[model samples]
Target: MIRASNVVYSYLKYGRTGEEPVSVRALDHVDLEIERGSFISIIGHNGSGKSTLAKHFNGLLFPKEGTVWIDDLPTDGKGNLAQIRQKVCMVFQNPDNQIIGATVEEDIAFGLENMQVPTEQMQERIDRSLEAVGLTEKRNENPGCLSGGQKQKTAIAGAVAVSPQCLVLDEATAMLDPRARREVIRVARKLNEEEGITVILITHFMDEIIHSHRIFVMDHGVVVQSGTPKEIFADPGLLEQYHLELPPVTKLAFGLRQKGLPLELPVLEPEELLKQLLRIRKGGGAC
Candidate 1:
């Protein structure tokens, strides 16, 4: 499990003379707990401290005031840094930045080699992770030769090959097209459900978060609210206050309901909205 208590981080500012040199609080008394083998999502607009919080989970930045623990191991860089990193892996928004090997298969095995795994075991891990990410056919291709989605899959395969207990995706799908974004989300879901890996998905895409067990909404530097998608979507007023917007399908359904249609007020999924529209049409609520 990952636990954070009263976590605080500040960034120093530098300017011309007599500026007072203020500090910006990127995370203000942030507190959260994530269980092992659970799937979760964190949503916020740009500059909402989503990335700052994600950095803490992996020990990239230590809290200035509080403690962050990964299953009782503190992220204070005393002696648990390497061990914590081994247990928790991070994938970034850009796939190219994470690539380390000349070939796809070699890239997957890079971490295993760094961990000094035996040659035979490394091959097994590479094969398994490639298949897991649906990149087995691209095993021998050049890393730069694949599409954007494929490159991201290759990056994920590399992380999976290491077999970390948890994977924190920091906007892993932001750079992909619609189809590629869906593809990445499907892989993340498969890893969470089939492999039972703890998945921490940080994204701005509301549709991508519908299947998460819980959603944490962050604004400015604090977590304003957290709940399941249903609970969060039900309060459109609260979301709008944070400069956040719902998925397009939810907006459409809510608009129709306001116009005297029988659509659900917070229809989160397109399928749910479709069902309500069908019911309204059959009941002669629409002209």
Candidate 2:
């Protein structure tokens, strides 16, 4: 489990004012608890602190005030930094920045090597990680030769090769094309569903939140609302306030509702919306 209690972080910047410091509060009195083996999505506008909060989960930045604990280990303590990082792994937006090894298998082995896994076990781990990401055949290939999606998958393989308890993706798909983005998301879903690894997905895309167990919406460094996708999508006004767009299907359902159609509050996917429309057309009971 991960917990943040009244966490606060500030950045000090220097201007041409004779060494004066300016502080910008990236996170402000934020509190949250993420359960084990659950998939959660964090969404917000630009500069809304979603990424800032993500950094805290991996101990990349300690809270200036209050506390952040990962599985009972305080992230602020210098002694626990290594342990905290090992438990929670992070993937960034750019695949280029994350890739280090020349080949896919070598990249997956990089993390395990740092932990000093035996040479005999390294090959097995490398093989397993590559298979997990559906890139076993590309193990011998260079990361530069793969497509954007493949590169991200390789990055994910590297992260999972370490066997972390929790995976924090900070807009991991932002740089990929639509097809590539879908591929990365599918891999993330498989990790959470098949491996039972907790997933913390930080993204601005509304479609990505549909599969999440819970959604947390942030604005101006504060958590404004959080709930299941159904509850969060029910209020179009709230989403507009945060400058967020609804999933395409949800928006279509909302438009139907405004036209005197008896549609449900939240229509997460196109299939769900289609089913609801069919039921309504057949004069079925309450949708």
Candidate 3:
């Protein structure tokens, strides 16, 4: 499990030498616990502390005032920092920025190489990682040559090669087109569902968050709300307060609900909205 207790983080404002540095709190006494085999999505606008919290998951940043622990290991300590990172892998936004290897297979092997996996087991690890991300055919291709979604998949493969217990994705699909976005989401879900990797997806996209096991809404350096997608979407005012809109189909359902049609709210899927409409029509306006 990932545990953070009253964690606080701050960064100094950069300016000319003459200017005194002022501390700006990015995460304000945040307390969070992410369980094993769970898929959690954190949603917030720019600078809401979501990215900062992601960094602490793998010990990239230590809390200024509180504590962050990955499993039984404390992130504030130095003894197990490398092991903590292996247990909590992070995939950042923009596949272009994450790229390192000359080829897809090489990228997957890079971490394993650094960790010094035996040469005899290298090909097996690379092949399995590529297969998991459905990039086996492109193993020989350069990572920069792939589409945005494929490139992100390559990044994911690299993380999985280490078999981390938790995967933190900080807007991994933000750079992809709609089609590519869906593809990346599918792969993320597969990792969570099939491999039981605790997946933490941080994004502002409402559509991608609906299917998560739980959703956390952050604003102004605090987690304003958190619950299942159904519960989170049940309150339109809460979403509005955070400058978030429901998925387009869900928003349409809410509008219809307000217009004398009793459509169920927080409709997670378009088919669900369609089914509600069909049932209402079949029942002659019955709720």
Candidate 4:
């Protein structure tokens, strides 16, 4: 659904007049492809350039040296800009920054209004979008009155109201508590599973990546590792080198393995760990 070829982007810091501008490279010759209808998570420490890559997916930032193509349309062209944005939408970290309208339904309809969606169909889309995010009851409520999780859901409803084919979430759960984070993630999973929207989620939390179909690990503005969550978590040395933590269950399994207990290499979830323990007991290998 999306492809980047040798893409490089730099930001110029302006100096006083007659002085040379300083250029800071944000993305350096990065190449990536996101399959249609797949859930992909990107993880990296701070300043790894993962967020920069997400912006390119929605034409928020065009590459200076290379090219970005969305559904076979070049992103840099003026004529293709609208189509590219329509195909991919972005949800940022702060709900306050994204929410605009006075009421929940109005905020959800903001995107469709910008797209010039017909007034007759706008109400239908707004209603359905609010329903999809489970915010229908709050349609007339002011967004500020909602909780953090509800605000995030409102942001998501706004994005989905346009019926975009892809969703890019850049640290969308960073500021929320654990409960709110899980709520946002559940909404994201539902969108991908039920709505068939391709999802590219960028986050620093290891637990969030456990359910992803695939993961891409970034380091110093480059993709150092890319694999399924199981493969990536199984290698402790690699995770340490990348400054990443293993999922809680995986860490427990690793600790058991260190004590001479035969355990699976990557126990991604609690249920998987429980099943492995049951098999071990049945095979007379119980610790």
Candidate 5:
């Protein structure tokens, strides 16, 4: 759904004194592709350029050196901006920054209103999006009154209300609690699996990416690793080299396997590890 080639983006840091402005590269020669209707993740530590790359998916920031294509339309063109944005929508880390309307329903309507959708169709969209995010009952409630997770859902509902083909979540769950994080992730998964929307999750939370179809590991403004979740998580040493780590469950599984226990490799979920242990106890597999 999205493709970037040799993309480079830089931020100009101006000195308060009289020094010359310095250009710091946020994305350097990054290249990758995301398939339609698939869930993928971009992960990295702070200052690793994951957020900068997310912005390129929807043209929030144009690349300084290369091109970004959203569903075959290049992001560099002014005329294609509108169509490109419609094809790809984004939810950022802070829901407060994204939330502008007083009520939940009104917030979802904000994008449709900008698109000049007919009033009748707009109401239908509002209803559908509210239901999609499981917030229909809270439609009349103020977004500020909702929990962190609910606020993020509100943001996702607003994005969905626009009828986007692809959704880019740039650390959308960073500020939420664990339960709220799970809720937001579940909504993103449902949107991808049920609605056939391409979902690209940008996060540092390793556990959140375990279920993703593919993962792109970024560092120093470039994609250093890309593979299926299982493939990427299989080697903890490699991830550590990139300043990343396996999910807590995966690390536990790896630790057990290292201690001469019979267990499956790359056990991503808690239940999967439990199942393996039960099988071993039952003599289904050797220790």
Candidate 6:
């Protein structure tokens, strides 16, 4: 559903008092692709260009060089901008920053209003989106008055109300507590599984991405590794080189395997680790 080729983006850094503006490259020759109806994640440490690349998905920021295409439309084409944006919608890190309307229903309606969707169709979309996000009961509440997770769901509902084909969640769960983070992730997973919307989640939390079909690891503005979650986690040293780490359960499994416990290299969940231990116990192996 999305493709980028040799994409390069730079930010102009201005020095104090009339010095030359330095061109700092944020994305350097990055190339990646996302398939329709798949859940994928982009992970990196700070300054890794994850968010910069996401902006290209919806044309929030055009690449300084190369190209980004949503569906078959080039993002650089002025005439295609509108359609590209409609095809791909984004939910950023801060719900406070994204939420505009006072109430949940109104915030959702904001996007449809901007698109000039007919009144009947707009309400129908709003109700459907709210139900999808599990926020139907809170639709009348003020967004600010809701929990952080709820506010983010409102933001997601806003994006869904537009009927976007792809959802780019740029650090959408960064601010929430663990429970809230899981809530947000659950909503994203539901949307991907049931609605078949392509999901591109940009997050540093390794555990949050365990179920993703694919992962793109970025460093120094480049895609250093791209593979399934297990394939990426199987090499902890590679993640360390990029200032990333394995999920907690995987980390413990890695430590055990290193100490000659014969555990698996990358155990994604605690239950998986326990199952492996049970098998070892049945075989009379040391735990």
**lDDT score, candidate 3, position 89:** 95
Model 5 is weakest, by summed lDDT over 10 consecutive residues, at 278-287
What clash pairs does model 2 have? none
Query: Tens digit of lDDT per residue, candidate 3, span 190-223?
Result: 9899989999999878899888999988988898
> What TM-score against the true fold does each predicted structure earn?
0.95, 0.96, 0.97, 0.95, 0.97, 0.98
lDDT tens digits by residue: candidate 2, 102-141: 8988888888888888999888778887888899999999
Comparing 3 and 4 on TM-score, the stronger one: 3
Q: Model 3 misses residue 2 by how many Å? A: 0.4
Clashes of each: 0, 0, 0, 0, 0, 0
lDDT of each: 0.90, 0.90, 0.90, 0.90, 0.92, 0.93
Give model 5's TM-score versus the native structure. Answer: 0.97
After TM-score superposition, what is the CA distance of residue 197 in candidate 2 from its true location, in Å?
0.5
Cα-based lDDT at residue 235, candidate 3: 84
**Could you give candidate 5's per-residue lDDT for residues 20-51 as a string of tens digits?**
99999999899898999999999988999988
Clashing pairs in 4: none
Find the number of clashing residue pairs for candidate 4.
0
lDDT of 6 by residue, 1-287 (tens): 79999999999999999799999999999888899999999999999999999989988899899989887888996888888888999999999999999889999999999988999899899999999999999988999999999999999999999999999999999999999999999999999999999999999899999999999999999999999988999988899999998999999998888788878668999999999999988988886
Please give me the total number of clashing residue pairs in predicted model 5.
0
Candidate 1 stretches greater than 4 Å from native: 16-21
Best-matching candidate per lDDT: 6
RMSD for each model, in Å, please? 1.7, 1.9, 1.3, 1.6, 1.2, 0.9
Q: Please list the residue runs of candidate 3 whose C-alpha ends up more than 4 Å from where it truly belongs after superposition.
A: none
Best by TM-score: 6
